[model samples]
Target: MPDGQSTRTAMFRVKNLWIIHLLGWVLFMSLPLTIVSREPSAGFPVRILQSGWFSSFFLVYATLFYGNLLVLVPKLYLKQHYVAYAAVFVGLLVAIYFSKPFERLIFRNFRQEQGRELRPEPPREGFREGRPPRPPHGGDARPMPRPNGERAVDFVSLTLFIVVWAVAMAIRISREWRQSERRAILSEAEKAHAELSFFKAQINPHFLFNTLNNIYALAVSSSAHTAPSILKLSQMMRYITEEATENYVPLEDELACLENYVELQKLRLNAKTSLDYEVKGQPEGIRIAPLILMTFVENAFKYGVSNHRESVIRIAVEVAGGDIRFLCQNRIIERNREEERTGVGILNTQKRLDLLYSGFYDFDIHNDGEIFTVKLKLPGR
Candidate 1:
């Protein structure tokens, strides 16, 4: 993806996150309006809103929610400061409890602003006028029961505070986990790219070294094919320097490069050597990793060609549906020390296949005394 497009996508997600949070808070703070009273004359819902208690409660909890999410969890809880985190958490809880009186004060002031004086509720029906009712046994007067609504409100406040804290912790922890996962994925990708580049670096020089040696042999012997070999070498070099720098190239371009390589190798072949190469299926829009198949083809010519014995090299490529299959078979011949020393290309190519294709591709090689064969299947785009 382009950097600008990725940046825009990230920004869009952040904006959506903020919007969702805003909507959630709005619904949460509006809960007081949903409270209905059996006694309509009590005006429970309107009184709750007008008293300013719910507003103050919402404000404090909102601050705590964000503070815990953005600061406490990240700076203390996630860092393993358990003792300090517990202490700070208890302190916030105590602060919330103490803030109840402040909330009542705001409610009182709000009522005063509306030109209404706050008043205590009248005693229950069992109580005499301005006098407490006696207990049935008359040992000691039983304490009057508190109103259910008042008890429910206190319980709900504490419950909501704990709920908000848990939610904040859950969100922060989840966000941290996602971030770490993203970092790990990016790190793996970068390492694979660097390793692949190192492999390509190895393959390029090894390929050039062998190709230049072939051209030099022809030039020294004054073979008429020397000039054409040099021209093919130039074309191959251009493809390497320009197109092959990308991770993938058109399948046709890769095949054309292979054809040029085969022609160049032909300049050194004798009557005892025979080469058969074939390509099937339309490769017009197919794309493959650049130079991925070159090392195997080069190995065929390197180890399978001999002036003194009959040698045969067979190569075939087929593209069907979304799959690409390649086969290379060559007759093994005795190799000199120099030829044996140049086995790095095949190893490097195998590593590249593992890095780029991994489980998505299949590769196999077989060597039986006189014959060597390689088969590879890869997914194409």
Candidate 2:
């Protein structure tokens, strides 16, 4: 679900798909090499050699097919050079058509040479007598009649050339479509990240001001906890400055940041407010969006804590089987219940989860009269 991983996966899939395409073409091409004729004059190996000669011509067609995909599509059609694209494509097709007969001539010459090599004439029977060899009945060896298979080679080559051209064009077009869609998705995600960053930037200043105020009060009161509180605040600030801008951070680091924030909040909250936090499993090698859980924790502190009334906030995180589950529950202050739904922090968190996890996670929130709860489940590691 991280940003670059999806792009790499898509590229891998496309590469595999094209490999399958090439293998299918190769299997189809082998038919000509294996199958000779029902009329049984030449052996299959001889036919295969003949087909190999024809295959050499198909090699040129294959080159053109791949060339059009890798070169022509990008340089001409995709670049909006429509007239040039049309002219070049038609020219290639015509050249392939004409080259078929040219190659057939070459195959015929090869067959003639092979025939001479394979079937030398027996010693002339009449040479022993004095009649030089009454020429064959009607004429000297008329060119051996071409086989039906050899005659069909040119037509079949042309047909395959056309078919391959069409297939290459189709694949190129589909690949372009997939690339464009990927670009659009990435663009939308970048826009969302920019907007979310701006919102988060706004949140940091306000949160720092509030935490500084709490620290100031503790310092003025000369409480012994002031030094450690300032140290905690420094650590949290360092984390926000260094790690928060990245796409993801170690889950344990994020949880440590939360612990620091909670400790700082404890310096300001009444002793009567009950806050319970627990971690249920190991967090090694796991990662999550930075500060994603802090919003809910901050909300709980902001609205659920009271100096006079007994208030409770509980947070728990569970990690198991490559899944992470987070739960935060707090009893709300009677008067602040209505305003809970509105905050830049909560809204930004929702947008981020949608962009990053989309189909890979579940998020839920509920306000049941007296208690507000948030639950998040997402893939880990």
Highest TM-score against the true fold, candidate: 1
Number of the top-ranking candidate, with lDDT as the measure: 1
Clashes of 2: 0
lDDT of 1: 0.82
Question: lDDT tens string, model 2, 1-381?
Answer: 987999999999899988997797777556444442333355644654466565675567668788988998888888999999889878876776666633464446555545665666687766665445656775774455656335534665566667777787888999999999999999997897887787678767767776898899999999999999989999999999998888788998999999988898887877889889998888999998887898889888888888788988999989988788999999978665675554566887888888778789999999988999999998985
Model 1 RMSD in angstroms: 4.8
lDDT of 1 at 327: 98
Candidate 1: residue 94 Cα off by (Å): 4.8
Model 2 alpha-carbon drift over 4 Å, by segment:
1-67, 80-154, 174-203, 220-224, 242-253, 279-288, 306-310, 318-323, 334-343
311 in model 2: Cα distance from truth in Å?
Answer: 3.5
